[model samples]
Target: CNPIAEGILMAHQVDWLRIQAQIKLCEKGRRTGITFAEALDSVITASSQKSAGGMDCFYIGDTKEKGLEFIGYCAKFSRVMAEAQASGVSEIEEFLFEDQDESGNTRHINAYRIRYASGFKIVALSSNPANIRGLQGKVIIDEAAFHRNVSAVLDAATALLIWGGRIVIISTHNGKSNPFNQMANDIRDERYGDSAEVYKATFDDAVANGLYERVCYMAGEVPTADGKEAWYKKIRNAYGPRKSQMREELDAIPRDGNGVCIPGVWVDEAMRPGREVLRLALDADFVHQALYRREAYVNDWIDRELAPVMAELDPELRHFLGMDYARHRDFSIICPMSVDMSRHRDVPFVMEMHKVPTRQQQQILFYILRGLPRFVGAALDATGSGETLAEDTADEFGHNRIHQVKISRAWYGAWMPKFVQLYEDGAITMPKDDNLHQDVRAIETVEGVPMIVKARSQDLKDPDLYRHGDFAGAGALANFATLEVTSGPVAAKSRRPRQGRRITQGYA
Candidate 1:
């Protein structure tokens, strides 16, 4: 229904609405020489149509000429913004340009900070500025909540903008507690009465009041539905009225900023013979590479402090390594971990297990290839540049099982659940080795899901019900039977599984 309107808007040639403002300013000025303040009021009044939505979309224009007129008006207003500077405590204008190109190239843009009387300047931003100065001008930060350093936005703006008496922060957000929404709410509650003119409104608020509806209607910009009705009438009846999800998002944040991701609700990783692996996870950051390194929680701590009293399986099984790759030589890493294990010490023993240089990638891979003589698949973690490297290595060594690794996706769908169940069921055991323990601790769960890999028989469980460790070579031997040659981006292997065949055997 909205396709045609979107198509038209996409092809809109001008900013017509602005042209009207220009004419109004000219006529008003002819009668009474318009002051910058008067011009500011007129511009705000003209632009404040709730119907036009946040940014201009539709207006008085039949052919593309009207669009061009709108563009001219917008440009003119921009010029006014570019000119109008320090007014008696009220900032007249400002503009910010920040975004990526169509091809995903990042662009650095300068902020235009203009004061009517005091000139303007552009400086490189180490961090986004919410306020360049106090009485002169301010800025509206784009994505306030998702920013890693949201505090930076507040510190800059509140220091300058609030003292100046004017501010208009704007954004379309997910919900409350989103830094912007929270700030807006705080302002709404008179928390910042001394600061600025804080008004929080969405595009919908403008549309409902007929302030911007004409433009919105013309452009087909309307609120989206929550989802389709349920298949059963009962389900539909149970479902409540449709609402924007912003409210729901507000409910999840920790009010107390102690860094506890989730409070009170603890995960239950109790003993269950057939479902032991509680969570299988992986993470790239080396700082917290060991899952036990630290978080405000208790997964690894339990394995150390309580695994003995829980499932008591620490040896007798086979352990092998699971590796996800990277493209560049710098990022490519190999972490050697043990399957059928439940402690950090065991992980450190499986040879070299640190994040090493790129030069060692092929050599370590060579050692792995030699150990697991049979064709063992590895995720060639490379997008474009890495792909070349992976292909070259595979060709040079005649190793063709180089699967393009999408580490996150595979773990989410395939590995996590299995890992959790294995932990819960006592399907894994660890040896008395540091490397193995560290690697196991390194395993991070994606969305609370575990990345379960294959293990071999003869797995051992401690009598104390604490640790579990399996022999390393045994795991590779078991997994070795399941592999088949599947080259880059192709379907999983061929007709018959190439069980028990060396990777170099296919040299023909």
Candidate 2:
């Protein structure tokens, strides 16, 4: 029989998530099938007869899109199980549900609900602590960690238990200090008593328990041990050097305690809002086709798009550029920094282009470089996919003005401190972007070296995160240009700092 066509299927930690419990919490890795299983369980709950032990199910996800996705799962499950047609359960419906605030003021919020013939309804609502207040029945809080007020939501969810309804909390941890993580830990420590049950699942756990096989089946491939292992290795290797991100995101470990390299307070102070930001966006096909013929299009893009943005800059200021060339799920980020008379390091422009063709990268980069004021120097990452870009940049910009940096522990140790020092001393300022803030904060001091934690491979379906530190790397390289200009690049022989004198301690 066809697995997916047969109907709702549970495997590995997914099966664990479906276990009957009055109160259940799932602390899981990314794409570990927890939510998928929750959707199936919800279907069963809403479809089963009341006397046979059925109850209404309410799913509150962290975003409106998540709510819709959860509902999509229900729609699919109902179709596969033939519940809607056979049992007369109504199709997914959009409606308004009444909710109340802490002050007891009533309001109506838009919601999606599916009514099963068993007289039980499964409702999916967007994340809002107040929205859950008047809700009764089994509550499933999906991505609980990312919710605005997890503690408050949990408080509201627990109210249903008084009427013998179940509460299911499902989420991947946001950070070690996140309230949801703390609650999961407390429950596991038995602080919530035996009524609380916590299920833990990691990427490795899913893989070991037939995740690859399921994926193969879904993709219509014959499941084989060798094929599964290959798929596993490919996914894991996609993370590259972001192991800490992997641990926190995929291995279900906390990262807040991993020694954050850039403090939030520092990032907050450096963030400059109300600054004009320049951006250039070209069609994917146009960029590819126009690469070799870039002379015509490139000149036009520079005159129209690039030149105007550069015209906003102070011509007297010495501008520097840093490039982190990347592709295939990673963005290629270019950050431009200026040294003002106040000695403040100002980042006036940050350009991030995704999946840009290689030749087009050179054209855009060259145009931007030629348009800069005083164009002192640029630091281009010379590692992996960046090698060709670095080589081309050196040829165009002159070797003295373009530093092709091969990123390494030594390079990170030497340059990252200077970058941190600029922040600590209030000599630097960056444009306001939440992802940029996250990129800086994602840096953690691992064994005295400050670097970005490479999280395990991210799902292609999910939007990209600064988890890879692309922005941070570009910013650091731009900062490195200033360091190189001032001191002619630190000697490659510079060894790690002496023990007890770690860079992290000075700022902490």
Candidate 3:
């Protein structure tokens, strides 16, 4: 439906707009503070841009494809437009525009010539002014969505357009690179005399309204009723087998396509009844996801690393306690552990994971938890390595006969799994919450591998994490847990420094 030639024509029209009298809305006053006649005077003129040297411009961009294109295309197009504008002007005017010409022309304009003709300025650039600081026009990036990264580039281009009439960008979008596609669509939407107020319309409607493609389909003709299918066949006929590539591009980006994603749980529902126990799983280094909530990419731990606990009013179990006994920044964090008489060998699963960054990281968790919800009891490392930074949160928070005891550092590969599957196949159902059920997937394993996982951190004394759609700690309210499985006395190497006569160590 889109045509590159149309881009060419639209680019040309934009160039023409620069020269149009009506479009010349230069609110900026004369830089020389002199009248036109005085500006021509050699003594009165502050400086002659006619020499075309020592000018300043800046551009900024993100890492997205569309952002990348904006900088590249705009830089390319500006020069191309300059050449097109030069067509009608005489050689005398060209020579007058500069002063160092082999042909004795004053308008030689060589400062940007070789670099511009060679088609790259970033390579030619070195050194830095305070504002540009050698990093001016360089891409600046942040996180966004799959295609939101496209907008970052657009933002950068916008900054470039602003500073030197350039752009700047902030972005995110590792999963779906739709932002750039939208950006390209935005450019196409504004093409062919559309200007700023390009009315929203489909490709057929755009062509019908003489938006861009005018000749091939003739103005006012409707696009094929079959939509993309018809467009594909026609492109195939016109561009031969290579048209498949074009059609794939069209398929890759369905303009105005509906995105189908379930909304994630708000932070509070994540703390309600049965949901709790957050896990941090790693897809890659510097790119981990947390399953602390019922949603994929979700988190609900009030404190960063400490897992939550549920205390029931049972008599025999009241004495047992979940003691996470030790910690530091380098090793696995030591979260506030929980214990009760019932949960030993009773946890449905124990999972090990790495945490990612921000609430935005919840996006990935929503995907996994939306379908799997069988997991229970995730003991966490509350030590601030990847969790929050709170001093003795469990101590200040342990009102329900609970405490944030440090787990004496031991081999994780062996002990954690035993703890993880403590209650596997045991009859444990999370207390019901509408939001939790909706966000967590209810699917059991087909090949005998259960998918749902949960951890605890949801009773009281939490940051607003529980209210913020993180439900990993919801299970802490069910007191049928057993945190004190092997607690005669933990005899592992002291994970913490034993300074002054350390006799009673690991006894939180």
Candidate 4:
């Protein structure tokens, strides 16, 4: 006879216990009662005779509190199933677990256990990679994603399967980049063969299987339609603006990855030819050159190269600029965007500089700003060393026309979506260059925020060169400037003669 009543276990819980795979994993939502179901199964297994497929069960949770909770469930279940057993169950026993490593080193760990008359036992041990290596039994890892070393924990747990022992890994997703999520993906791809399987149980799944009603029953309150709706809404509303965290915890969806955000086709569709990508690379000795020499060199290059491009821009169209800054390693990119009557944003050209000194960077930037027709505004990366340049630019161009942006996760969450929307709506056009293409593709949805990934992409033409989404950042900042900066009456150029020493400009 079954010890559990017909409605005692939810559908997902029953399904979890029903899985007989040697290595089964469950990526589940919070408060789904999977742990409770597992506890009942563990008690049954511990009470069963050796001929009836009974063996020892070891539970490893991420926290000490979780261990106590699991053992409590086992104790309760053992008493409930007393009638089915020929012998009585022992009281909960607290003991030191002797964990041994390959080097014959042993360490004592605090553990709680319950022994059955059938010579089988249920043990709940503290979370530690070394704790699972020497155990020979069914291993259950709870909240595997939150473990200190998820990879190590998984590796040790899988070793149990070699000795005819079963392994169960259960957790809600931490992030897509997390090893637990990777393991789950590997399992779905059949990387683990037929011995392992992955199961998912979301909050909605549990609710549909009478979770809310069960909660009501436990609270000694009558369940109602309005009450259920209110309860569900309350739980969701508690997350506030943390929608990604809510989705990950309640929907079993993993957040963040190195996956491409903008597909190549989308980027390609937005690209147009005939756009210029001016580059300036300076030697190490450029910084030590005399000030006048540096100024003269850059000024000459600007007049020759930048002048022609500036002349081609429509004087009537409003323009904006976005800049991503770097000094030595990565390229500092400047993207100038012109908006036509149709509200279409066009990138006239992109400027890239490598190993260029800060003073020359400012000179080139000032010239570009002064040249852009009807310049509305510009956004500059003000993070780290870029702060000084951005602040100086804001001071020179008037604070109203320049935005010093502090690049961060929160900023990306707010602004990156708008930039992405431009591409999706076909409202923006950019240069058709492979490097720029790769830079834009570097954006990834990290923790549900569309931001550039940490990894850098090698320059297609120059393998020695690398980019950290320089153009993409500038583009996003430029787009932000256009949307956020208010367009005021254009200031007329001063007819007064310039004073003081003139800084020369030339290409590096």
Better of 1 and 2 by TM-score: 2
Model 2's alpha-carbon lDDT is 0.74
Question: What order do you get sorting by TM-score, best first?
Answer: 2, 4, 1, 3
Candidate 1 error regions (>4 Å): 1-74, 78-136, 146-148, 161-165, 194-198, 211-213, 216-508
Candidate that scores best on lDDT: 4
The lDDT for every candidate, in the order shown, is 0.31, 0.74, 0.27, 0.84
Kindly list the per-residue Cα lDDT of model 1 for residues 329-408, writing each as its tens digit. 11233322333334311122222222332333454444443333123344443444445656655674455554443345
lDDT of 1 at 227: 19
* 3 or 4, greater by TM-score: 4
Instruction: Give the clashing residue pairs of candidate 4, or none.
Output: 295-504, 297-505, 297-506, 298-505, 298-506, 299-504, 299-505, 299-506, 300-505, 301-506
The TM-scores of all predictions, comma-separated, are 0.29, 0.59, 0.23, 0.52
Q: Model 1 residue 456 lDDT?
A: 14
- Tens digits of lDDT, candidate 4, 1-508: 2222576888889888888989899999989988989999899888888899889999988777799999999998888778555467998999998887777788888899999988999999864547576788788899887675678889888878778999989998877877789999999999999999999999999899888888887777888899999999988876555576678889999866523456454677789999889988888889998987887887776766777787798888899999999999899999999888888889989999998899989988988887787888999999999999999999888899899999999999999998888877889999899999989877877767889866676777677788888899999999999888896524777221122233444334
